[model samples]
Target: MTRVRSLTAALSAALLLLSAAACGSDGDDTPKSVAPKTAALGTLTPGVIKVAVQPYSPYTSVQGDKIVGLDGDILHHVAKKLGLKVEPQVTDFAGMLAGVQSRRVDITIGGVAWSADRQKQGLFTDPPYYSPPAMAVRSGKTYKTVDDLKGLDLGTVEGYVWVKSIQAVPGAKLHAYPDANGVFDDLGAGRVDVGFLDPLIIIAAQKERPDLKISTQYLTPPTAAEVKAKPAYQYFQPYQTGFYLPKQATKLERAISTEIDAMYANGELTELVEKYGGDPEQFLRPDDAAAAARRGVDRPSDWTPPAIAK
Candidate 1:
């Protein structure tokens, strides 16, 4: 009987050990520790992100090989938020679009305007950065409002919605130019009595040529579709810029959208515009530069950046 009891006790001990082993998994069945793998944000990662940038003045430009401008600065901020290094590739305004489509760069930061057409090509983020006002002004007469250009020969870049808007008004002859600069130059030469142009360029031109007259009144509030319709028109207005990602770039798109929202919440975006050329009080949601700067941070010192309204 004693021998039988001892055998039973031993059997119970073995069963307990087996149960423990089965429950514990002996490090074999244990869940393997997932090594902290870095996220694959395409060919780009947390350390370095290649960007396509345009040397368009006020929005983006190259300063001694360093990409600099309101839009470039905003991309730099986005890069910083993502804990990534930035490498900016300078290209022509039209070429920047090609770089992004080819995946030669992870992103483009040259104040690209969002539009329904571009949406067909790839994904875009929410809330356009800036929409600079467009103005209809007479050649030599400084008018204060759209009413001033009511009977004048108002010109707009061909194929732009702004031109359509001008055409809607009776007696408003819409002369289409290949580019805004040409329209403005024509106005300067008196070939056209008036031209519609981005307000900032108008401001810059007005500063340089006081003899040129602009109606103080803006003809229309800028929209992203107008800016995105063509790269050529974008080169003229260049505001209402938004982030562009490859089609179905879900991870990268989500990261950028999150960072942009955080920036808006933190008010860092608002500060950038104040630093650039926009009114802080009026340009909060519709115009923020922080996202533009952070997305393209090429240098350690450029981690903080802003502005696409120029």
Candidate 2:
């Protein structure tokens, strides 16, 4: 009887050990359960998604603690779509890229064009929205095109692609400034013969400075390959500026891209852009899906819009 009891005890112990092992093994060690609660699909954690921005007049700006403008409006919509909440971390144009590169801000949209150099370090919006370059000069001169400034002294913003074109001219002396306002000031004071600024800012300046004149003609840089054939004038390509995730956030990247495409197809995206004072036609077509396909752009998938919490 004692021997029989010992055998039964050993069997029980073995069963316990097997049960314990089964409990501990989590199959593939993947998450067996989702978070008990989630804010929304696209919304970042509350107060997350730091945005870097500057006053790109008519598009985005900082007033008091709130960010305003077309891009701001679109971002607000993006937050709502993502089911995440965010507040703008306003900074100067010069600091925008640094903010994103350092992870201080999750994204930036201060009219930054998608250049080859930036692409080396950043991921831009799947499709560019708008790009209209302008020429700013003192009251008296006229620049029908960049070729007209062959022998002139021009002021342009440094670190901007526009400067690359302005600097390439054979006899064009370029003075680089830190900001758009500075560029205009230098040109107005005759410190530089001419300047290149964004069209919206140019319009804002005209409202404020009756003496500042801009040509109706848009001057942007041609592609590097076209430099030899095109005049050394500013010729901007369609720059689709949008939120950029860090290189590691592959999940977030795919999610945002998919949802954005959905928004575009539904016309919600274009409507929101227009509400913020942008020309939807510049970025989307009546049939957004077709438009995106034609442009070889990505579509939105899963995300939620941002909310304005009072």
Candidate 3:
């Protein structure tokens, strides 16, 4: 019943995006003023946002011609506020990374982890949520800590935030795949002893194969890592999920951040997340480690996230 409700809401959101996409603006390269308002974003196209997306559900997914997910729901409200049309293009992970860099698309979505290395590729929007990476192992196996993974074969998607940390694990063999499906497939087939991936993807995989014996465990790394120089490694933290825009799209980044802030302030973001099968408290709010990861990023010295009610 919950799944059906989520699907129903997702379809409704997708319809809203489709309607917005249909309402193209006249010859003007600015935010469109369809009804209520048009944001003053320095968009590449006039009143239209060409977005790149990979089909990662609960984040973003290709449902027919429209994109739907938690990210998509946020985008729907954001577009309505700014009076902009959404044009989403479906592509693989590489295309999502490259499309925004080349300015071929105004932005890209679908569970892009916030990282310093990837930020060098393009501008990343403020995160709407943060999710922990998962350690997928055979059911009943007691592998909880990083030390437990020694000498075992592990698989993860290419460009995942934990790749560096996983590689740093002594005696652990890392196999990088192009996408999440391949990682789980290999894990189920015993090609790899473990699968290191996003927890949501792990949930989806488990649903697909209920008979498969697998368990989801959150990643735990040491407080400080002298081995890896990265901040995520130093803290052993989860990544903030955000969007990638063209390198010079600072104004656009700020504009989008403002809308995200509004949603957070009014609890819209949390409600939307919860309705989509996400745990708002777990994934939406940043814990101590994630706060450390945030400080490591290039935000203003005085920067702070929306205050959660105690």
The candidate that achieves the highest TM-score relative to the unseen native structure:
3
Q: What does the lDDT come to for candidate 3?
A: 0.68
| TM-scores for every predicted model | 0.62, 0.62, 0.75
Q: 1-310 in candidate 1: lDDT tens per residue?
A: 0001243443444344334324532334222332232245543434556666655566667675356656667777876676655666655444455556655567767556665556566666543255554564654466443445567787777655566556654576878887667776777777777666544455556556656554433433324464455323332332445677677566777677667767666777777655555544334434333344334332134433332233
| Span of 10 residues, lowest total lDDT, candidate 1 | 1-10
| Cα lDDT, model 3, residue 2 | 6
lDDT of predicted model 1? 0.55
RMSD (Å) per prediction = 22.0, 18.3, 8.3
Runs in model 1 deviating more than 4 A are 1-40, 43-46, 136-150, 158-161, 186-194, 211-217, 220-240, 280-310
Whole-model lDDT values for every prediction: 0.55, 0.54, 0.68
What's the TM for model 3? 0.75
Better of 1 and 3 by lDDT: 3
Higher-ranked by lDDT: 1 or 2: 1
Arrange candidates by TM-score, highest first: which order? 3, 1, 2
Model 2: residue 143 alpha-carbon error in angstroms: 3.8
Q: List residue ranges in candidate 3 displaced over 4 A.
A: 1-39, 158-163, 175-178, 189-191, 226-236, 287-297, 306-310
Q: What residue runs in model 2 are displaced by over 4 Å at the alpha carbon?
A: 1-48, 54-58, 92-95, 102-104, 120-122, 137-144, 186-193, 213-216, 220-225, 228-238, 258-310
